[model samples]
Target: MSRTAWRWSRRPSAPSSPRSRPFRSKPGTWRRCSGANAVMSCRSPAGRRRHRPPEEATMQPEPITCRLIVEAVAEFYGLSIVDLLSHRRPQRVTRARQVAMWAAKRLTTRSLTDIGRFVGGRDHATVSHAVRVVDELRERDADFRQQTDDVVLAVEATARTLARFHANGPEDVDPVAVARRILATPRGVPIVSIPEITALASAVSAQELTDSSKMMTGPMKRFRSEPRDRESEFDLYRAVAEVLEADRALKQAQWTHGERGAQARLDRGLKALRETFERETEHVD
Candidate 1:
């Protein structure tokens, strides 16, 4: 045997002192093992503990109401007003309740506490759980996520419509301009028909490019069309589009060229476009 084996044979079978005891792990708690590599190992794999999620934080309420979120969700899901307010556990109602909780958190400035209370008196923890569940479902279910997004959009659109009507006045407002303005805002909802508004905006450029030859003025093309102001609906809308495009382009050119001689041309174009727009609107009115 080698010197090391002889020394091991001569040593005591076990240490007598308390200081020489081997380490052990305890239940429900972590304890590091009693060995280390030559490298610097501050924490062993055994010593690392499982992490717990952080607690929910409180928040102040926002201007948007909890009722608005709840009603919108309930309506989209075809559930009764009492469905969210009551303790019923029909799968559909439960889904709606959870979605409403999630949306209330998103749309309203309401705290988790208030969100829970409004959505069937759930507590903050429950509300948090529901929010997580809905998020997971949205990840797994594309259709469910789409429906939820659509409902949220319509509710926001309704809110915008009300706010716009109140702020911009009820009469003589250009619906297309208001729609474009709203669409320009970040996270803004479309108060009116988004498609129609977009179509009108696109037609502005298209009509400007079109020539007088495409006017559809021939009897075959104008058949049965009750024309007003000697121009059909298509002619009138196209004229309006041309005018709007001219005005928009002039402003762009002015911004690009500033007070250079190019601005004189833009100013003249704007004057003509405004006159044309006014004439067309007057004919329609």
Candidate 2:
């Protein structure tokens, strides 16, 4: 043991500094902290204390205006206010008026009595009855149901645009021009008799015939008979016409072909046979 040279060796100690204190929040208190610079409280519930963003409040309902409701109804029914208020009870007009009454009651906050007064001073009971009638008709009739829905949506849109326009100022747009545009649009051709089709085309100011098409092709025959047998001849002609017209349009289009020419000759032969049937029917009649 060389005691004279022995000495104790010690490890160097870390430098001492003040420790940062942990945040302590009071019970039920929300911390006012922000972003990455935030310090969370140990007492807060959860994985991390995050302040939630404020939620948006619900929108308030707008006040319903009388003009909006009336205009909406008029535009939807494709009728003027004067006509709607008239006492006419035609099927289409009455149906449209009833629909207007129904829409006014539904879309506006006005009382039933108020709605009735606005709609040509009708009684509240009458308005109620009209609404009920339309409701029942919509359930029973497919066409009526579609018409009602289309009118309702159109009126609602018109009402909204009107509200905005009035709130701002009067609009410069011409309503008549808008109406003419709507009228100019073509609609689907409904399946109807040839006579009815001609009438409709005339009413719409459309051409009744074009160079590409001919009068509908149908069987035609002439038979000599006594004056009393005229009804039988007419009936025979009608029956033949029905058969020919009932054939597909494509088949009728091909009627000029050779095969159809032969069929036409055969059809003529059948008409000769019809002579006997006509004679028998004439005697029976």
Candidate 3:
């Protein structure tokens, strides 16, 4: 037979229809035809439909509140909450207060009026003025700009701490036990310390932080049963959370720099916690 005739004989079968053609897939995988059309349907080795698993849920950072911004600023500036809320016109106090207002406006979703109320009960115009002043200072004053950045960092860190607490906090959190644990935490043996950490610790204290935490955590049951004023409750919660945040900052400082730095941080933090407690008490009353 001729080579052409031999080749022709080798092609014995016609092409199959699309629906009847063999389906190709990678090794260890196969496609099943569900109907007459032979549409490819993916399946696992167990013969179950393969499905893409759902994306894991992510925990979002909580919104930074105006009060938290103010608290953080006051803590950074070494001023009390009263100093920010007062009508005092000292350059130190005024500058701290304005920066706080600016931070509140930048970090929170509050209106200018609301920001003013959170800071010191001023009107929207005051908040606008503060924001403008801060902008101008940040442009012209390197030192002031650095200070603002530090305050912003502090506020954000504090907010993240609170967010984590809210997201993964224990449902059966015991205020008294937590407070006792906080109180029992040792200052650790004195050692090398960072000045900044020392300053923060000196400004705030473990006692104040524990007290604030207790106050906030203690009333959870009451909150569900009683018809308390929402505004007061909110203020109290913020105040308590700020204190707790301050404590955490001190602990981190301690971990990094040992006892001395932690003490300084605790001192600074205690001062701020005290101011918050006093302010929240006034609001509640």
Candidate 4:
């Protein structure tokens, strides 16, 4: 018998079976896979599982409810809902309460009637009245408008954060201080105006350029030989004009000469002018 060489060929190994199929993820971690199936599994500490896609999170929370809104408004303004809902007409308290009611209406989704009931059991009409009053006041009073705006913004921001928490999400919002800073700029005031700029420039120039000659001149000297009871209006006017002219001349001389020369000339001129005026005025009196 001839012995023929026999070769053994290795066949492909059988495919391994998947022991455990992909598991379902928790409520927030569900994602679709290539197999067209939803997978729900968090990565293990041992790093055996594949990474999961992050879920889209909600931003801010829903606005505050009517009741909570009223409470927040009351707390911010230091007034009870009862006081706010009251029919009392005291100016300060009434104004504060009206502002609170107005804020509650604006910051919540509650119906007007519901908001009124939450705020001291007021009627819808009362709430409407309050809001109107506050609106009118805000139009007229800058301080009141600013105060209301601050409280409303704070409450609304907090409400939004709470809403985000309820939705199991996070939101990025600018801080309240940033909003306040933006709003704090003075309203209805121009940043620059030609008339105002010109006026300011003129004032600055006047302050910088002061004539010093008049200050260096000696005081006017007056000599009256007799007491004058009354001087005519024309005579008074002429005397004043003469004194003013002498003063101008003294200043002009002072501007040109040294202090000693200016002083001597000013004194002599003032004395002679004073003597003449006094003598004439005494005769009239």
Off by over 4 Å in 4: 1-57, 80-89, 164-285
Clashes of each: 1, 0, 20, 7
State every prediction's TM-score relative to the real structure: 0.36, 0.36, 0.40, 0.35
Colliding residue pairs in candidate 1: 62-109
Q: Which pairs of residues have clashing backbones in candidate 2?
A: none
For every candidate in turn, the CA RMSD to the true structure comes to 18.8, 18.1, 20.4, 26.0
For candidate 2, which ten residues in a row score worst on lDDT? 205-214
lDDT of 4 by residue, 162-261 (tens): 6645642222122232334545775744354443343343233222211112221222222233344455444544555655565455445543656456
Cα displacement (angstroms), candidate 4, residue 236, comes to 76
Q: Write the candidate numbers in order of decreasing TM-score.
A: 3, 1, 2, 4
| Candidate 2, superposed: residue stretches over 4 Å from native | 1-66, 163-285
Q: Which should have the higher TM-score, number 3 or number 4?
A: 3
Q: Over the stretch 48-126, how does candidate 1's per-residue lDDT look in tens digits? A: 6433222212222224556667767777887644445555456887888888888878877778987775555568998
Ten-residue region with minimum lDDT total, candidate 4: 207-216
What are the lDDT figures for the candidates, one per model?
0.58, 0.52, 0.62, 0.54
**lDDT (10s digit) by residue, model 3, range 1-285:** 999999999986998999998987766443332331232333344545564322213546667776667667777877655456656566998899899888888877878877775555578999899899999999999998999999999888776676766753112122333334545766744332343232233223323434444654554455445555788667656655655565555545543656566556556655665565455455333
